[model samples]
Target: MDKAIIDFFQNFTTSNHFILNNIFIFFTKIGNLGMIWILISLLFLIFKSTRKIGIVSLLSLFFSFIISNLFLKHLIARPRPFTTYDLKILIPLPKDFSFPSGHASASFASAFGIFLSSNKKSLKWVVITLASLIAFSRIYLSVHYFIDVISGVGIGIFCGYLSIKIYEKIMKNK
Candidate 1:
């Protein structure tokens, strides 16, 4: 099923130069290192009101990095889809293992941290939407399986929730 879904997107990417060229590929590339989300988190930190969530966002990113990149990816050691299948990797090939997509994990972890720590509903939606697209881009670019991104999303949201809980508890005690 995961291969089937990746094949569908790979076909779509090869099928239309316009959409792939103008949009999806760009997103997949942009999400490299979670740079896009990191930029957003930085902007959030610039504002006084959003500063708390911004801190949470960065914390979540940190936790996601250690958990997904440091531990889970090494432990799972899932092969990249492109390695297993004959597909053009749309971006610079990722060197790390693929079980839990670091892109998906970091993006969602930071975004959900922002969402859970802040009261701004509109910003939450924007962050979540971008995170969702980034997660999709992993599978779209042949760097990950659907299940990898799913596991990432699961890890990300959990980390985000845990960050907020810990932050709130520390603050409450202080």
Candidate 2:
């Protein structure tokens, strides 16, 4: 099923160079090192009302990064689909193990953190949409397996939930 989905999307890698180059690739680039999400979290931190959520996002993002890149990726060490298949990679080939995409992890972690801490429906939806796009771009660009991104999303959400629980506990103690 994963291979089938990748094969199906791989078709677009040839047919939609313009969209791939201009849009998906742009998302993929922004996901590099999870830079854009970090910037968004920082922006949220600037406002007093949003500061707690912003800090939650940063904490969750750090946990996601460490778990995805440090532990899970090393433990699984799944090679990218492009590693063995002849696929047109829109972005530069990534060197890390590919079981859990760090981009997906960080993106969803920040999104989930915002969701947990903020009451604004619009902000939550916007963050979710951006995170989904970042995760999709990984598979769209041949950098991750669909399963990788899926696992990343799950792991990231779990980390976010954990962070929020910890924060609540800390507040209660204070």
Candidate 3:
């Protein structure tokens, strides 16, 4: 079942080359670029109430990525999909571990953080869709295995939820 899903996305990587290429480039760059996330954090900081939430979310995502990619990756040292398979890699080969995608983690961490902070149900759905799309894009680009993406989503969601709960507790205490 998992192989089928990975194979399906691998096929899309070739069939939807144009779209996947653009998406892969976007995600690859944005996921690694700290400047973009810093800028986003700054934007959120402009609004007093959102500032703290933004900081917490950003910190949570950073910590999650560090633990997953830096510590855990080195410890587990799982190989990337392209390394183990015959599929054509749409993006440049990632030098780091591939068990849990950092892109999916950061994307979902931000999306879910925003969803938790906002009162609008519609916006939550929109953010959820974006998170899902980012996760799908990772698989479609052949950069991440099915398990990697799923684990990333789980980790991201947990970090996002934990950050929100911590923020709420801190705010209430103050």
Each prediction's total of clashing residue pairs, residues at least 3 apart in sequence or on different chains, is: 0, 0, 0
- Writing each residue's lDDT as its tens digit, candidate 2 over 1-174 gives 878888888888888668655688888888889898789889989999888898899989999988999999999889999987889887788998998989899999989998998999999999999999889998887778899999999998998898888888998999
* Model 2: how far residue 65 lies from native, Å: 0.9
C-alpha lDDT (0 to 100) for residue 135 of candidate 3: 75
In terms of lDDT, model 2 sits at: 0.89
The lDDT-based order of candidates, best leading, equals: 2, 1, 3
TM-score of each: 0.94, 0.96, 0.84
Q: Judge candidate 2 at residue 145 and give its lDDT.
A: 88
Query: What RMSD does each model have against the real structure?
Result: 1.3, 1.1, 2.3
* lDDT, candidate 2, at 91: 78
Candidate order, TM-score descending: 2, 1, 3
Global CA lDDT computed for model 1: 0.85
The model with the greater lDDT, 1 or 3, is 1
TM-score of 1: 0.94
- Positional deviation of 35 in candidate 1, in angstroms? 1.7
lDDT (Cα, 0-100) at 22 in candidate 2: 64
The 10-residue segment of model 1 with minimum total lDDT is 16-25
